[model samples]
Target: MEEGIAIRAENICKSFGEGDSYIEVIKNASFTIHKGELIALIAPSGGGKTTLLMMIGCVEEPSSGKIWLGDKQVFADKWLTRETRKIRREKIGFIFQAHYLIPFLNIIDNLTLLPQANKTDDKTARAKARELLKYFDIAEKEKAMPSQLSGGQNQRVAIARALVNEPQIILADEPTAALDMQRSVDVVKMLKQIALEQKVAIIMVTHDERMLPYCDRIMKIEDKTTIFEEQQLQKNSTHSD
Candidate 1:
């Protein structure tokens, strides 16, 4: 593991079935994501975009490959540890297309649940949750239910919740797909801000090319392999004219 490298994958492969029924999805994919970087993962439908993301997030195992989150090598042909769930809970944060905040829990409670479940004291967890709520500018909604907030507000809460654990890596899958253009842009900007401020690595799977400008780099899947490209961000040109 290299300094500041948050994720590293080498010769990773994934397939299903065997013999005549075998289907290969990804092959020989390799890449490294550094801390404080926001990367975009783009590919055609069913092109293993989410599959690769899931593998990195430890939700899906690679058929044969080596994966490292920070300095720990968690997989090589097989998962190195039986506690994949623990790894996810401790080292990774995940964001989905939908804001899956518990409907029964208020905004602050939704953020505190994971930390408390991970053994943090209730007072500490609530304090951290309050800090995140303030950071997201949703502090006034601490006691509001998910159903009471707008779509964008709930999504902000979702992003804040992902940060509550202070994980080294964040895996976001189409986080802004459900929002309108302006809202989507806002979400991407927020992600970029988080990566820089928290010094965390972020991999976002997106179908929208318009959001690429906000990312630090782009990772594309082609021919069952991975490609990396650097992004050219303008100085003070992130806004539309």
Candidate 2:
């Protein structure tokens, strides 16, 4: 069986500048994410939610602390390797508020781009892309352009693209922001299912409290510190549907 813990961060701090011009955004932020968990990261705007997520994704450097992805300690104040991009592409999947699909390419092509960049063979990448499209129930739209898809469908494609690499963790930044209320709820439920079924830990940054009832835990930034609140599973499941 695979280990359940996917991410572990200890006493992380992120600051910009130094001396008189210094500003601290995150102070001693620490948390853990386990596989099969869907966690919501909520806070007021500009409260370091995205900053913390980016640090975990290895896109941003932390001023201090330790970060472990799966069993690998990727950061201890400084990055362990110059191959941060490679580590990110391989271990972490990212979903953004915007679909950001390549408008010029067909759905399959857009989905295959990442794997291809990682040097996956054309045939294998195509096969994986088709499988993900089918898993998301968009297989028939494989050859269609991004402009031809509905908002929900396009977002699904974007998520499929994220998962095509078979990452251990997913970092979603306001993934449901552009959708209607019902669509947003549906998307969150799907994310919950994905986390459990795929056994991939997921952390989503959002301001939507409606999403809170679906998440297993809520991580919040309050007064420059990060804290986790475990959800009532009964209440969460009730609201999720």
Per-residue CA lDDT of candidate 2, range 136-177, in tens?
A: 899999999999999999999999988999999999999999
Q: Model 1 lDDT vs. the true structure?
A: 0.92
TM-score of each model, in listed order: 0.96, 0.95
Question: How many backbone clashes can be found in candidate 1?
Answer: 0
Q: For model 2, what is the alpha-carbon lDDT of residue 57?
A: 93
The candidate maximizing lDDT is: 1
- Give the C-alpha lDDT of model 2: 0.90
Ten contiguous residues with the weakest lDDT in model 1? 232-241
lDDT of each: 0.92, 0.90
Off by over 4 Å in 1: 235-241
**In model 2, which runs have C-alpha deviations exceeding 4 angstroms?**
234-241
Query: Would you list the clashing residue pairs of candidate 2?
Result: none
lDDT of 1 by residue, 6-63 (tens): 9999999999899999999999999999998899999999999989999999989999
The TM-score of predicted model 2 comes to 0.95
